[model samples]
Target: MTLLHMSINAHDPQRVSEFLARILGGEALPFPPFPDCWIAFAGSDDGTAIEVYPLTHQLVAGVDQVECRVGGERAEPTFAHIALATPMPADEVITRAGDEGWPARTCNRGPFQCVEIWIEDRLLIEVLDPKMRADYRAGMTVRNWRAMFGMNTQ
Candidate 1:
């Protein structure tokens, strides 16, 4: 199975979406389903995308629908993060994120290396350039993961 899209809360949805678009080498567009929401399309064959929502907005469960309401207070950093493959160089990714005033750095994740970019200094998005992506694919496998923890990889 492949991941198609994910939703994230941002202090500035529009700006975040635009920045994500640049990283993905795609475009940022308004999301019609919700007001002030934006989507960053990765322009890949799999149609990978990220939906940026306002930090105050919360998704509520309804009887048969999901309701979006603006009532959530500012939240602290979340442990959740996504790793995306990008065609851009690692240095360029770091440079772009730094230019946007976000803290970004290349980190060695043991099995792989990735650029950890903190969005709005609140959320984390791990970006993998071509070389990093290659290392990730090689190192991130079911067998490797299990073996790392001394689990039987049968």
Candidate 2:
């Protein structure tokens, strides 16, 4: 299965959405379902997207489904992160993130390399450019993962 979208909280949803859209070579638009929320569409065939919500927002179970609500709090340096594929160059990604006043650096993940961009100095988003995405796709295999973790391939 493939992941089409994921949600993240940002101190500035509009700015974050715009940054993400530039990275994905797409567009940022207001999320119709949720007020004050923005969505960054990757414009890819698979419909990859990222939903940006306010930092204080949270998703809770409603009567019939999940709903976004206020009153949630977050600590800096959350463990949750996403590795996104991008068509932009690695240097451009780093530069753009730096322009946003966010800390970004190239990270070597043994099998592949990605740029780690810290949003609002809190959330982490690993960005992989074309070359890096190719490396990721080549290295991130079930067999390779099992071998690295000393798990049985069978």
Candidate 3:
């Protein structure tokens, strides 16, 4: 099956959900099975979803960890890596994110344009391919930069 949304556990999901909802087109979702809260955005009727899991309460005290996604891959994002849309212009995304207290960066990654963010922690997000992003915004396909970091591009 296709990859689903990324999950993050937070203490104030309501606030976080509201933020994501406005910035990333996500909507708060029900979270009963887990002890934490959740928010999600399924880009379209037929596509992948991005899930946010806020840890209302930790499984054990002193355990504070949030998931991570780098270059379209999921892992324990030591940084608050967020996925963003394209065609929004890298400059605009960075400015907006910074204004919201979430720092963002941009670069032309080969054929894929990218924007990385750092909010609360070191977040890495991207706004890619102008053409595809417009299409994805229209529900044609996914609209985030396929983040790539390396000696060649970071």
Candidate 4:
């Protein structure tokens, strides 16, 4: 089965959609059926996209609570982050993200390396190289992440 897209909540859907399009090599197209929402295609041909919805938009209200939040204690059922495979070099992508004012960091664990970037300091997107994903599929864990990422899980 092919994956088409995934929807994400954002305080400013337009801003977030534009950022995703630039980073992942795509375009932000509006959804005519709903105003203030967009589809950010990572690759139009591949049909991979992020459905960006405004947190406070008409469609979102009354369905559930929506609020913008920075990194901190996350409650259960919260969307932690979204991972997308990219052919671009991790360092270059991270640099571009940082230059654009997004907090980006390199995460290298052993031979595996990827870039984690937060869009507007609210959404986390992990851009992974093919090599890194291969290694992960072979069996890698958070144990390796602590050393490379300096994570405070302990």
Candidate 5:
């Protein structure tokens, strides 16, 4: 029932892959089966992974919007942003993100707090606090999860 991996469309897969590896402490490995993709495997040794794919690659079919219709409006998913539980402090993550030129902001959604970093100024990544990730893994509805950790300010 645990998440195994998540694939994201990246304008530059190789660069994004390296960026994720540096921030998330993962190995960016190329998939032999997919010539144009790489995977940034982070989290626990047996946890989840972040799959990086070229945005324009044939695989993605040019559909870049990762959105869903809600109340007749387009909106992002609750867990839309990739959440990474890090051993490093939240401040450290922000510092590194800044050094790498990624726009980052500290956010608190209800009981959960994280530093949301926009990779390449487009992709969303939430550097989570290790202390609170357990409660995050406890499984709440997407609405609750969004209300607690999503980026929707409205």
Candidate 6:
């Protein structure tokens, strides 16, 4: 099974986390460096964690800004990021996301023309395509197909 959480570095960790939380309906989280708050959602403890921290990097491609600043080395986030799914319908999720200042756009990537996310140089998320889910289920149960190349169930 795929792991559950992904982390990212944030110039304003609280703001970035809250930005994600609003769309995902996550709980407010306490930020590090004291007296600040971040945001996160609750899920089964699938053994994963996300850590957001501050850095300094000038806006390139002009999508980011210094909403707040913590002076130090201008460390650009060159590591992991996260993708969050909405329980709400995709259209509603898109609309609500725009309303909450997450500029979202959709594209297709991966097998069978899957729907994917390009959330502003953040995480690349594939919105669960119903067809893909069904296909996955079918593939798992089809033993003749599954056993072809040493995938035989014990």
> Candidate 2 on 1-154: residue-level lDDT in tens?
2343567888899999999988988777776556788878774523466779887775543343334566546644442457788889999999999999987888776678888787786666778888887777666544554465565555
What's the residue-level lDDT of 79 in candidate 1?
27
Query: What residue runs in model 6 are displaced by over 4 Å at the alpha carbon?
Result: 1-74, 112-154
Model 5, residue 61: C-alpha shift (Å) = 25
Please list the C-alpha lDDT of all candidates, in the order they appear. 0.70, 0.70, 0.44, 0.58, 0.57, 0.42
Instruction: Kindly list the per-residue Cα lDDT of model 1 for residues 18-115, writing each as its tens digit.
Output: 99989988777766567788878774523466889888776543233334666558545442346788889999999999999987888776677888
Give the per-residue lDDT digits (tens) of candidate 4, residues 87-136. 77778888889899987776653444557676776565667766656664
The lDDT of model 3 is 0.44
The model with the greater TM-score, 2 or 6, is 2
Estimate the TM-score for candidate 2.
0.53
By TM-score: ranked, best first: 1, 2, 5, 4, 3, 6
TM-score to true structure, per model = 0.53, 0.53, 0.32, 0.39, 0.41, 0.31
Which segments of model 2 are wrong by more than 4 Å? 1-74
For residue 88, model 6's alpha carbon misses the true position, in angstroms, by 2.1
Selected candidate, larger lDDT, 4 vs 6: 4
Q: What is the alpha-carbon lDDT of model 2 when measured against the actual structure?
A: 0.70
Q: lDDT tens string, model 5, 1-154?
A: 2343466756687888778877777556564335567667663434355667654433211133222222322223222346677778788889999999987777653445667777776666767766646545443223333454443543
Q: For residues 50-138, write the lDDT of model 3, one tens digit per residue.
A: 44454333221112222322232233433223444544666777788889987556544333345655555444454543653544344
Q: Tell me each candidate's RMSD, in Å, in order.
A: 13.5, 13.3, 12.8, 14.8, 13.4, 13.2
lDDT of 1 at 150: 67
